[model samples]
Target chain A: MNDALPPSNQTQHSSDQDKPNTPITPNTRRILLVCRTAPYGNALARESLETALAAGAIGAKVAMLFLDEGVWQLAQHQKPQGIGRKNHSAMLGALPLYDIDTVLVDRDSLSKRCIDLAELGDFTQLIDSLQVKEVIADHDVILSF
Target chain B: MTLHTVNKSPYLSQCLADCLDRVSAGDSIVLIEDGVYGINCATSETLSALNKAIAQLMTLGVQFCALRPDIEARGLQTTSANCPFNLLSDGDFVDLVCEADKVLSWY
Candidate 1:
């Protein structure tokens, strides 16, 4: 697993440098995207990811938290062969490309599901349930999917 | 006021119920996706419970609405006389989001 620190400095600089003279507005809301469902059973997983990407694209500070059945999204070697849906596992890897580096998975969620930390991708951090509450309190907007 | 969005059906999930419990007076609720199903005024066990909860919340001055596109996609009607929610277009949805102090989306 890659334990490298996120390159947030570069992303923040790039997003801000373009509009140096512009005053910061309330419109630039900090968003936390909470994923509570498993990846394939519904459209929520994909829609949440798209929302995060869209928020990040518009230079909003975006973070994602995985809870409950959402930890299944971090499982390795997923192949939705018969599911007739586009595989979104690779899309998680693309979060950093959109400058969405703060990906979190609940510790209790992973433990309850018997998911190993190694099974998750390198970009995700394992946070406790209390930290999840703090994460929610830290963001200006919360979107659950 | 907060703009709350519920995208899960109340009959299928406890999301709408939980959201209703937490929303303060003057907050706006926008039902989207499968949540538009909660707009049914039909008399059934689940629908009755949902209607009761919505009526109670409305008494507290909370505003309720559903996305027009999602309601149409689900083949559900949201008339002012029967339904507790108003219809919001895509543009109106954006306006509501921007007008609110914060957005809380419940799935």
Candidate 2:
């Protein structure tokens, strides 16, 4: 039997909460991380979130775009307790603290999966195919996970 | 140009199709690991549909490639004359990765 507990907010000290946002210089790389996997049953989704936070921590301007099954990471009321996994959405809710404020979602992917935008919260910006194309062209670095 | 690597089979996953959908005109897609199955004669409905999508991307100048080592490991038969995409050795794959400004791996 496993007794491991999910990550807690205690790690984010109150002092750490007030840390100044990482400044982006003129030369800062605009990175786009396209996440296309679902949460749980695999580590890809968590890894994608970690990459976005890590990149943001290093002062790179980062944008996280969720497409296909990746949108599941943004699904509301996720209960991973039964599965013995951490709450994926809780980790995502911490993106802004790391300065990762840009989160895009493919409207088509959402529609196909029948997921309403309200369910994902207002943190995500809905983007169409044309917008997705433009976003891909705008980024200096694109990493798909 | 971006170097996109798809390491999953078209028959088993949606990685290749999704990658093709988002790729721009100048991007290159390298098929590695199980992705080599993409070029294995499209006799099924799924492969045919995926092949059509790939064909459309090819017309837009998206170069497709597969790793030779993985192909050999999977015992995939590919003669240059009949193969649709470039069969790359380990060194060539490294070169392709070096040439691209960024890389996106579809696992």
The candidate scoring highest on TM-score is 2
Question: Which candidate has the highest DockQ of all?
Answer: 2
The residue pairs in collision within model 2 are none
- Tens-digit lDDT string for candidate 1 (A1-145): 1235367866676677687556545446677888978898888999999998888888898899988778888788888877877777788988999999999988888888888888888889989866765676567777788
lDDT of 2 at A17: 48
- Quote the lDDT for A133 in model 2: 72
- The A-chain TM-scores of all the candidates are 0.81, 0.80
Q: List, residue by residue over B1-107, the lDDT tens digit for candidate 2.
A: 88889988888888887888888997898999999877663334656776677777778998988899998888887643644588899999999999998888888
* lDDT of candidates 1 onward, in order: 0.80, 0.83
> How much of the real interface does each model capture, measured as fnat?
0.45, 0.73
Please, what are the lDDT tens digits per residue for candidate 2 over residues A76-136? 8999999999999989988878888899999999999998778986677999987887788
What is the DockQ for all candidates, taken in turn? 0.25, 0.49
